[model samples]
Target: MEQRKEITMSRLQRFLVVSLIAVFVATLAPAALAESYKFGASKPGGSWYPIGTVLQRLADKNYGDKVTVEIGGGTGNLLNVMSGKLSFGLASATSIQEALKGAKMFKGKVAQAKKVRVAAVLYPNYLFWLVWAKSDVTSYQQLKGKKVNVMPKRFSFQALNQQMLGALGIEYKDFSKVNYLGFNDAVAQMKDNHIDAYLGPGEENYAPIVQLATHAPIRILSFSKEDVAKMKAANPGVVPFTLDKTNYKQKNDVNTVQTFLLIITNEDVPAERVYKLTKTIYDNLGDFAGAVKAFERVKVANATGDMGAPRHAGMDQYLKEKGLLK
Candidate 1:
């Protein structure tokens, strides 16, 4: 009877311990699951898609259970971040600068961009226009009467468009038909011969255009020194660049303007979470250098560049701790 009693007590104690652990895990599930975030990569046609993918994988690999990235892009990411619908997303430094001023790109949505903050600098991009070989279009002047997809709708992209076109002494009305569409749609339509030309501004060897070239056999329109000068006159941030044919599938080099890209968040995110994320990025910056063509230049040292938006307090704290902040 004594042996049986001892055995029964041991079994009871084991059952009680397991029950307590089950309850503890159940209680923590909400907070654990709540850590996941929706990030915007824009459409599949751009660097945001692929670069964002690599960034997501790197973050998840380091802090997978604490983070999740979603597909999104353009002003959608900015507006969503403003609305607290996203944890963060990618956007251009120029547009974010304009948005912070409550004019230019963001216009009436100053409140939205006001909530926005920079988490990291992804890379820089350059603007280049392309036409199909069959179009017989040789210059920006020839695009005056043709249907054109300007790539940037109105918000984040409009500034670049205005700057580039203004330099050329042209406007949206100069085109017979103008559409504000994503890079993916523009590439698809161009491939089908639905559009005459595409005005694309992006990182060197942007995937959508690079992919489009493989099957479409396209050509980038060359800019004259006077046109480039006028473009530079429009935006000082806009610098002259040359895209090598060997890199982007063109027969020759193409001249364009350059700008920086960034990953952005809003003030709504908790400081701890943002700090943790910023930590993950800088700790693994070297691993991301060659994730994609444009990201090759990524450096933890550039984490504090003039991204035109305020840095999230969490991000700033991490940078300060690392002495990465000046």
Candidate 2:
């Protein structure tokens, strides 16, 4: 009888150990099967790249393990994702719209347009101009006929700048001189007081803008309700916005216009994998905010903001799971 009781106890212990092993494997099985990916982003020092680095860092610690990030052009990033050549990319909603129609920057209708999918809306790209605080440029309208650097021709910011001017019924040709200069030259010209204003968009605490503020008190031009409406009217994806007065060296909140910046991927990735990536990002935004200032504005409400391209089935599923898709 004693021998039989011992045998029974031994069998029970073996069974319990096997069950725990099976449960552990079940929990981690998906991660083991998870696919690695490359993230295409803008050049280093640009606002977009920092977000990508944070993304990969979190993904590597989660399921999108060892994800590779690349610095590349906007059009190529989105196109590569759709073609399955890249795992993911960052792009603006407007650019994705153009690609869908094979218009503007794209030669024709993109062959892989259908595969393009949205992961999340990172933040809105705000467009405005800035000058030293002592300068008398009072409003966005006042900049008309002033010597301004609207960024150079290579960045494709020229057309966007033209749209901002058109909203105010001003033409690019109307400026005293529309200098197609780079950021460094713009800052140099600003310090020398050679230029009256520098008009462009970037993160509120954009390094160059912040650097300029260090040498001279700077003021970013603010848009009125009516002008913001007109600008958004002319541009479909843009939304009216205001900067926090307390942050980024801003003395008062300034009104502006914003276009959605999207994290995009393709249909080739499995639904479950994309779901994990989307879920992780939204859940861990606090961790990423440390990497860039723009992150402070990444609200959950904007997670489902329209991005022209359809949402990946995986991302959509995650949203639905969290009750964010309603």
Cα displacement (angstroms), candidate 2, residue 4, comes to 15
lDDT of 1 by residue, 260-281 (tens): 7777888988887788667766
Worst 10 residues of 1 by lDDT: 62-71
Candidate 1: regions farther than 4 A off? 1-34, 52-61, 64-71, 133-135, 152-155, 224-226, 249-252, 285-291
Colliding residue pairs in candidate 2: 102-108
* Deviation in Å, model 1, residue 96 alpha carbon: 1.1
lDDT of 1 at 203: 57
